[model samples]
Structures are given as structure tokens and as C-alpha cells.
Target: MSYVLAGDVGGTKTVLCLYQVADDNSVGGSMEEIYKAVYPSAGHERFSDLITAFLAEVTQRPERACFGIAGPIQDQCCTATNLPWVIDARQLAEEFGFADVYLLNDLEATAHGMLHLSADEFVELNPQAMPQAGHAAVIAAGTGLGQAIMAWDGQRHIVMPTEGGHCDFGPNTRQEDALLLFLRERFGGHVSGERILAGDGFGNLYDFLRTSGFAAPNPAIEAEMANEDRNAVISHHGLAGDDPLCTEAMRLFVRIYGSEAGNLALKCLPRGGIYIGGGIGPKIRAALESGVFMQGFLDKGRMARAIEHVPVRLSLNPEAPLLGAAHMALLRSQG
Candidate 1:
């Protein structure tokens, strides 16, 4: 029995998984026995710190390793987007005593994991259609917005990482333009989808609504939001229909999310489909299914027909990136 190690490194947490590869070189089973281990990325500036902790928790050393990171990977070195840590693959390979080590953008991992997911694992947002066999897009929102695309090249899906999320936010209407202006003022120009679609974007949207005198639940909730990061709190309230302001904020977020999804689809010409992955999509499924997202997605005027034909689905699995890393590692080991 051969085992491989995989890691999903994020801004807030890192997940490690061990997998058992079968005779056919496919993952037979996996045990996510380890979780939520404290990784002070700021203090421990090396990938070895986290790898050491992960090794300490597991009994056996993995033959190979791969990591899905939050930042661009170039020349075998990766710098995390939300953290100060820099990861060098050569250094990690030497320290871990592995024959091979692979690093990929987090969204790339998400795209790879799509091949491993069963239909039951996904929730279809647009059921009236099916994905065409061409290209597929994956966009996720967690600590930041991440986008990637996979091209169906006749035989297999080729995963490609993108900086589409960093592109300028193009507002459609007056209200959206106002939101863009607000974000620009706060961010000092170059408002990207990341500005309005990430974790921080939720709070920014809520704050905008509150300031615009939208109806809120109570002064106490507002105070709680002001005192702390309020996106999750506000999102929960909005999802539960507790606060009008939160609900409106969420609606706007969904609209922007759908529009961005549309933009990505257009750029990629993703006939295969659009898969929405990330921490935020699963949490806000209700709002996304409430027609706001779909409407915005299909509201591309004359091009609405193109958007309508594309199927949209949400990835419900949080361990997808880890699985993707393991798959990448497995492929490399076999090769």
C-alpha cells in the first residue's frame, strides 16, 4: 500500500490529508484524520514548520507531497497572499526527504478536484441546462477571490490558474457603480472583484448598506459589527432572514458574484460549465439560489442566451483542494 500526503494551505487554516493509492494508481481511500492545527505563518516563515507539525501528527512519512497554496507559484517558490510566509519547493523537498514536491495555486487545486467529485457532491444552481464540452471555470471566495479555468482538450481536463479576480470590477448599473465608487475610495483605486466578493467584501457591503440608512435589526447588532469583523455575522443574519440590511447586502453580493461568474465564463468560453468553489459559495447557497445570482448571470442582454446554456454548480466539499493536491502528487509520482 502506497500513501501520499496532500495539503491545502489557506489564509486562516491549513488542512492535511493522507491517501491510499491503489494498484491502478488512483486514490482508493483517504483519511482526513488531522485538522485545524495551529500554524503561525507569521512567526514560522518556512513551509517546513507546518510540514513538521503535520509529520509529527501522522505516524508515517509520505512518499510524495503536494500543496495547494493561496498565491502564485513561480520557480518552485510560493508566497501566500494573506500571509507573510514564503514557501520554496526545493527547500521543502530537501527538508521532507521526498523525491518530489509539487505546489499549485489554490484555485488550480480546486479545478483539478472537479474530476474527482461525484454528482452527489455538487448542488446545481442552474438545473435547466448542462455543461458543454469545451472549457470550464472555477471561482472561489474565501480570504480572497480566486479564479481558474480548465480546458477540456478532447481527452482530459487541463487546469489553468488565472488572475481574473484581480481584474477591475465593471459595474452594470448605477447602484453597482456606486458600490464600486465606495470600494474605490476605501481601497484607493483599482477595485477588483476581490474587493466586493471576498470575506472582507461582505463587511464592506454591509457597512455600505448601513450607512445608506438601510433597515437593520438593532443598534446592538450594528455595534457588534462595528466592533468586530461582521461579514459572517451579517451573512448569518441575512441568510436567516433576521435583518433587512443584511439581506439586502447579501442580495447585492449575490448579484455581483453572479455577474463576475458570467464575466469569467465569457472570458473562458467555458462550454464545459462553471463550478463555484470556495468558503463563501457553500455558506450562501440559499441566497445564490434565490434567483438574484442567476438573474444577474443571465442578464447579459443579447448574450443572455450564451449564459443560459451554461450550467452552474457549487462545490460543497471543503476538502476538495486537499484532494486535488493529493491527485496532483499521485500523478507526478506515477509519471
Candidate 2:
């Protein structure tokens, strides 16, 4: 069987997959896979070591490879956004002795894989409408907020990456303004959407709420999160309905997340739809479906009518980026 190696390289962990491409132009199946391998991207300083390890572990040798990198791709090389690792495609090609190699923005890869997702793979937060074939947007909140747009270029979908999450956060109300002030004092200067929307951002927001007197602390959730990482503990407490502070933080998070998504929809004109991807969205499925997200999304003043028609879906598949990398490798091979 013909196999292609695909990887989703993240800040904390890397996922690698060996996939078979089918005749119908879809990834047939994954023969081998690795999930959540801990690699110290700093100090180690090379993607080659990780690649070598993956190659040694897999049973089959792939003919081609594609990677979804966590940072900008310029001239076939990249420096990871949060890590100190530098990835050189030419060096990787030399090391792996592969004829084909492709690098893409991580969010772009996720957008490409969205084309193949079935209804069962996603939880529809807003069932009020469905997607049309036109423009679409994918926004993810993980270690960082990643954003991308997909437009139908007459025949097929073309994914475009954006640094939009880095754009300045616009306050919607007095409460948000106060939150911004609190964050500015802590972080200094401008605050981006990523500052309040990602994994670390959850804690930041929670801290802001606590310090700003927006919510009172619930000792149980606070203690659990204080011992562990804040996001997971906060989410657990919020979902369990055990803590009022956790609940409020979650509500605010969903609102901000939805507002940003709506802003993205407006900018991209995603008639095809808006897809919510990344680690956070999937875990808070219940909160997103509880009208908080949709309310924020449709709360736009005059343009609300336009956004109301757009369908929104939460990507349930965690392997989307890997699958997309394989799909890109297949496309490149065919060309």
C-alpha cells in the first residue's frame, strides 16, 4: 500500500501519522499513529531529531511527507511560535531522503481537513442554520488562537491563513474595558485576542475576573486549579456546575470566543460557515450550545441579519491537522 507521512507539530506535543490515500481522493485510513509525544522544542533545537524518532518507530517508510507547523512558513523554513526550534525543510528533506515535502500553517491544514469531515464528527452549536458553498472561516483556541479562511475559488476550496488573532482586542462593554485595563497592567501595552482566548488566556481571564471583582471565588475549583493547570481545572469545575466563579469565567470565555468568531465571519464573509476548532471548543460543547455563544455571535447591531444566516460547527476530530497534511501531500503528489 502507498503511504504518506503527515505530522501536526505543536508547541507542547507532536502528532505523526502514516496514511493511505484512496482512489476517490481521500485519506483511506491511518496505518500507524503517534499522539502526544513530549519533545522539548527548546534547547534540543531541531525538528530532525523528532522526525528521526518517528521514522524509527513506524513500521513503513512513506514516499512523501507533509507537516503542519505551529508558526509562519517562509521559504520552506520556520521558527516555532512559542518554542525555540527552527525547522528547515531543505535540511529535513536531506535528513529524511524524501522526494517531496510540504509545510503549511497549522490552521490552514485544519481548514483543508474540514472538507472531509462528516456530520457525526462535529457537534453543531448553532443548529438554527446550515452552511452554504462560498466562504468559510476556521478559528481555534489552543496553546494560542489560530485563525484561517477558506474561499471557494470557482471549483475547489482555498485556505488562507490569518494573523487576525493577534489583532487588538476591542472591548464591547464597560466590563470588558475593565478587563482590558487589568490585563494591560499585567502584560503591559496592547492586549491581543490571544491574550484572553487561549489555554493560558483562560487563566488570565479568570484572574482578571477575580481581581476586578466580577466574580467571587469558589474555594473548591480554585484549589483544584491552583494545584494543576488553570484551564482544565476551571473547565471541569464549570462543567460540573460546582463553582460560581468557574461558571462565570466560562460564560465570559464563551462570549468573547463567540464575539471573535462573529468578527471573523464578518471579515471573511463565511457564507460556507464558521468552524470552531482547537482543544478548547470541543471540551466546552455544552456551554457553546447553551445559547451563550450564539447570543454573542448574533449580538451585532445592524449586520446581525447577515451573520444569522451562516452555519457554525465545532470540529470534533482531533486528528484533523494530520489528516490535512496527508491530503496536502496527496495533492502535491498528483500535481
Candidate 3:
């Protein structure tokens, strides 16, 4: 029996899946699952430890494996952005006796996964505009902001990885200018767009508003923020409209998200479409649909009309990266 392993490696958690493909190796053949599990990345000191544990749970070995990791990938290796771990495809192959292995930047894998998604997998943020055939762009905010470009080569989609998220955060208003200054003081250096647009960005914006004396922090929300994931807590209260401060923060967050998404649209001129992936997009679909996101998106000044025509979509499938890694593993096994 031949099997392949696929994984989605993140800062907070790691997921591993083992799949057994049919003997014919047809893409449509039954790809039975052998095993699947999730592990807390912080619980293990090394990725090797986590991988070994996954293998221990299964009796059989996989012919090949691929990992979608959150970081820049080079030469089949990647050093995780938020986690202190270095993953090398060569090391994994040598140690596990796998026929082959691949390491892909998480966003690249997510972009690859886009090709296999159905219409139901996407939530239309702008259905008014029809999708025209051209280039496409993907922007995601999670542990960090990730960007990718997709081009149709007259056949399949080719994904090009980029670190555009690390680009400087351009504040469109005086408030954002102040927020940038605040983040500068907090980080003591260059503040990238990710500083205000990723998972930690929620807390950063909230803290800036409070510290800048623009808003008073609610004691109840403050307490909850301390006890739980600050960003999640803020997002919950923001969406609920239960706390004015949280709600304002949420508004600002979506606006920035929208503005950045617009920036992507302008950069690539993606008439094919723009995909908003990552964990945050699907959660705040309500706010996204409320026109606030579009307000910020259309604030593109002269290019506003051009961007307005670009179709924007939210990827509802959080496991797209994992699925893409699995597909890559299948290709590696066949080769």
C-alpha cells in the first residue's frame, strides 16, 4: 500500500494527514485517508518530534510528503515566521526514508489550492462585477499577512510567491498616520503592513486607540483580552457591537483589510479576481458584507473605478493550504 503525507504548519498549531492513493495513481482514483491529526506547535521543541509522533500513530510509511508552511521558502527549506522551527525537505527525506518531500510557502500552497475549489467554496464579496479572464491576486491575514500572484499560462494557473505584506504600511488618513507612529514606538523600527493587518494587528490597533487616548478601554473586555486570545476577543465583541471600542476597532480592522486588498488589486490588476483567504476573512464576513470593507476598498481615489470592477471573494475553506500540499504530494509520488 502506498501513502503520502500532507501538513499545514503554523505558529499555533500543526496538522498532518496521511493519504493512500489508488494503485492506478489516477487523480480521480480513491484517495483513502490513512490518518490525520493536529498538534500544538508550542508543545514540541522540534518539528522532528511532532513528525515522529504522527508516524508513530500510523503503522505504514508514506511514499512522499509535503508541508505548507507559514514563511518564506527557499531551496526546499523554510524557517517559520512566528515559530522557532526550521523545516528542511532534505532533512525530512533523509530521516524518514521518504521518496521525496516538498516545502511550500503557506500562501503559495493556498494559491495552488484555489484552482481546485468550487464556487460554493467562495463567498462573494462583490457579486455585482462579473469575473473576467486575466491575472488574479491573493491576500491573507493570519499569523501574518501573505500575498501571492496567480497567472493562467493558457493551461494551468502558475503561482508566484511574494513578501508584499512586509511592505511599509501606508496610512491613508491622519488617524492611520498616528497609528503608524504608535506602532513605530511599540516596535521601535519599520512597521510593515502586517503589523496592522495580521492576527496580532487586532490588539495593536486596539491598544493604539486606547493608549492614544482616542477611546476608553472597557474593563470587561480588557479582562477578557487578558484571559483569552486578545484578537479573537476583540473580534467577537466588535462583531457583536456590544462594546463601542471593540466595534470601532473592528471597523478600522476591516477598513485596513479592505484597503490592503485594494492595494493588491491595483498592483496586479487582477481582473480574474481577488481572493481573501486566511482565518480572519471568513469570521468577519458579516462586517465585510456591511459595506465598510468596500468603502475602504473604493477609497482608492483615481483608481477607485478600476478596482471596483475587480471581483473580490472570500475563501471559505480554511484547509485549502493543506489540500494543496496533499495534491503536491500526490504529484511527487507519481513522478
> Which one is best on lDDT?
3
Tens-place lDDT digits, model 3, residues 1-335: 67889899998899999988778867533466778999999867778888899999998888898899988898988888778888999999999999899999999988877766789999888746679888898999887899999986765567898998999988898999899999999999899989978988989988888888877788988999889999999999999999877888899999998998888888988888999989888898999998888888778898888878888988999988988888778866676
Please give the range of 10 consecutive residues that has the lowest summed lDDT in model 3: 25-34
Q: Candidate 2 clashing pairs?
A: none
By TM-score, rank the candidates, best first: 1, 2, 3
Q: Runs in model 3 with CA error above 4 Å?
A: 23-32
lDDT of each: 0.82, 0.82, 0.87
State the weakest 10-residue window (summed lDDT) of model 1. 27-36
Using TM-score as the measure, name the better of candidate 1 and candidate 3.
1
Better of 1 and 3 by lDDT: 3
Q: Which residue pairs come into collision in candidate 1?
A: none
**In model 2, which range of ten residues has the least summed lDDT?**
27-36
> Mind sharing the TM-score for model 3?
0.92
Residue 257, model 2: lDDT of: 91
